[model samples]
Target: MSDLPPENVQQYPRPPRIEPVPHLVVVRLGGETIAETTGAFRVLETHHAPSYYLPPEDVRARLDPVAGGSFCEWKGRARYFDVSAGGQRAPRAAWSYDAPSARFADLAGYLAFYAGLMEACFVGSERVIPQDGDFYGGWVTRNLTGRIKGARGTEHW
Candidate 1:
């Protein structure tokens, strides 16, 4: 509803693309503010909702490194984090790439949160919907078009 054009995830790039999010991004949980920033990046991939990444300096919650690790071809190796705020804990609810691929070098040390694990996440003034399923961490907001990944039948997508 803002002045931005609608994002069609189906048409997103295969290797993923990063772009600056010019809106205010905020993460809140258990009545406490987890992270807030006007400076954030959105990663868009095919058949997926955009994932917003915030800088470490903007995160106000506690992030404890966890054991699980994963590798993304475009983003490189990722490490998990257990986020704690307002006395509530969500295990491995966030992740960051300590060293990213050259294409995503700007994402180094940037934290991306699971909207489903938070009380609420906001992009600009709109509250976001968490993408379905447990396999993907995407934030769904208004003005996004096309079929999104992380849904029940989207496992292979």
Candidate 2:
């Protein structure tokens, strides 16, 4: 268990902040482990669960780049990736910011998986609950507290 205080999403920053995650992060799909890493970074934003980004080198499966991209005011351009393993494919299930803004430049090349699209995702031994909707890639764990964003009516939040 971590000695740090319990995290409440409500108290996270509006612009978001990145923190190093020492726990093991794992992504499972198509009945196999596609990615596993002890080194992960999480982006914390107000009203949202943490979005964990794994290093590119730690990912086992090949991520095929998708056509579209998006812009994050804080992070810069976001690129999509399709992940496949064991005959299952999740289109645009992952994303990365190649040219992030200076403040978030550390996120460059890190991949954040959509837990809902994968068979399972875990933080250490605890299975994570995916943040609602396909838009945000946050992962909700048992240790978190507060009303999270991403539900239908919370679009403006």
Candidate 3:
């Protein structure tokens, strides 16, 4: 019923894959008002690298505004935040890519943390930095064990 050539049809691109990067971030600050939590998040294994995403209502930790932010095509515009442990400030440790694309809007306002800057980071209680650099944020959870992976800029994964 068609007139086009068989090879003319192109397959649609695949969505970015988000594998779980198992890890835990423990917060121990001097302030009693702000609670300390361990292994309270999840990380994304993206094409560019890994990024940490924390459950909004699940995080017992308090966050303050940081100095910078940027835009993500798949996600959206983001805002950075600072974290405090024992009342000690860990600058720009949190970020939220608000107003993400329809497929990835779930990421909106969900905080992503950088393990390298936190007080302590553990991969299955092994004390490892999931990724090898400071540019990525490795997602984590309390009991989950695995690495997250996804392709950046691609809407479908």
lDDT of 2 by residue, 1-157 (tens): 5333588999999889998888889999999999899889999999999999999999887689999898888898999999999889999999999989988888899999999999999988878899987688899987789989999998687
**TM match of model 1 to true structure:** 0.95
Give per-residue CA lDDT, model 3, range 21-109, as digits (tens).
33343433334323223324342333333354655664556688877788765566789888775667778877887676776655666
The lDDT for every candidate, in the order shown, is: 0.91, 0.90, 0.50
How does each model score on TM-score?
Answer: 0.95, 0.94, 0.58
Q: What is the model-wide C-alpha lDDT for candidate 1?
A: 0.91
Candidate 3 stretches with Cα past 4 Å from truth are 1-15, 19-49, 123-126, 139-157
The numbered model that scores best in lDDT is 1
For every model shown, the clashing-pair count is: 0, 0, 26
Tens digit of lDDT per residue, candidate 1, span 91-116? Answer: 99999999999999999999999999
Q: Poorest 10 consecutive residues of model 3 by lDDT?
A: 1-10
Checking candidate 1 for backbone clashes, the offending pairs are: none
Runs off by more than 4 Å, candidate 2: 1-5
